[model samples]
Target: MTCFAIARDDLTSPDVLDLLRLHLDEMHSWSPACKVHALPPEKLRAPDVTFYALRDGDRLAAVGALKVLGEGRGELKSMRAAPDYRGRGAGRALLEHLIAEARTRGLIWLGLETGRTVPFLPALRLYESHGFAESTGFGDYVPDEFSLCMELHL
Candidate 1:
């Protein structure tokens, strides 16, 4: 079995930067500019956001972020697994880590927004498998045809 390390990342290194670019590019490809909600690396540096990376040895396999929405609410952001690592459990591992982090912070709710397009079906399924159910837009988000929102109560 491949051992993966999950840790907080500063999002400045070259490999992590490349992974972020790929994630943004794919999100843009699947959704229009107005519908693309994935945060840029710089925006994720905000005090309320915690960014993490999952690595298999020196290879960066996946990345994800958790943004505190206050009042016991949290949002999952920018979750993406490297193409080569897809279906190999990296995404799931990263997501599980984020959920644990949220619980550790005493968050009562965890929400996320993902594209409604076919490209995001796997992601939707992944979230569903983790006990997230479809939910209305939360925080500053508004309902839109291209976006599917889901939340889990911790």
Candidate 2:
């Protein structure tokens, strides 16, 4: 698929939210604990969160967001891809897009929180494959057995 990145404003468009809702529902169905944080549509308007939407033509197929946490650090959040687009490199595209965006913003490190469950193994692999390594919890995520933190130096 031909994919390109757009700002969070584009990703949070009404149509994009509908797609994200479906993605979240699918993840939730797989595991109740795999909760995708739901932000009011308005919350996505914040400048601190840099979101990238990968689209095929007019359809948004993947999305990922980077939240600046100061101290040359960034937190990855709200990463998901349309179910039909999985295994087609959409996830990797969105991730690499976000990593580039982070560096452009002067962030030296990028980190994220994901579940430690089996279903999240693929998610962990994606980050690991992209050069992210194990890291201590940062931002609002607390240290917990269920959470895995990974970071990559820019």
Candidate 3:
């Protein structure tokens, strides 16, 4: 919420990796191990993925990624705001940045999978406000009770 900048992350910074670990831990807490699709650091560095970090000044405020699925489509990955930055618009800032990047890269739509539980309500609301709606599973994901898929047409 205070002078944050969204920039492409190389996924090698110690703070970025620590935040990613926090994101993974939170995901695992809300869903089964098999259903947790948040990418690991090595996977995030894959050729098709473009990771991002939202820095509030020198501190990392949040992180997210866009994984090119080819054919004018992409998937949103690892959208998480640090505890100290949540509810202060850090997530929204990062989300907008990714959507803009997707558009810049010529992606027509963006897809994401998140938990369907009450614990995930805030995230669901955030995505919905940005025009993401209920959708069938994308990528390697499958439709299931614990999983909620959404898509935003860019």
Q: Quick one: best lDDT, which candidate?
A: 1
Q: Write the per-residue lDDT of candidate 3 for residues 124-143, one digit (tens) a residue.
A: 99999999999987778887
For residues 1-154, write the lDDT of model 1, one tens digit per residue: 6789999999999999999999999888888999889998999999999999999999999999999999999999999999999889999999999999999999999999998889999999999999999999887677677898999999
Residue-level lDDT of model 2, residues 13-87, one tens digit each, is 776787667756755665444334434344554688766777877877787778888899888877887877787
Q: lDDT rank, highest first?
A: 1, 3, 2
Query: Candidate 2's error at 109, in angstroms?
Result: 0.6
RMSD of 1: 0.8
lDDT of 3: 0.92
Provide the lDDT at 119 for model 1.
Answer: 93
Q: Is candidate 2 or candidate 3 better by TM-score?
A: 3
Q: What is the TM-score of each candidate against the true structure?
A: 0.97, 0.84, 0.97
Question: Cα miss at 41, model 1 (Å)?
Answer: 0.7
Error of 1 at 56 (Å): 0.2
Give each model's clash number. Answer: 0, 0, 0
lDDT of 2: 0.75
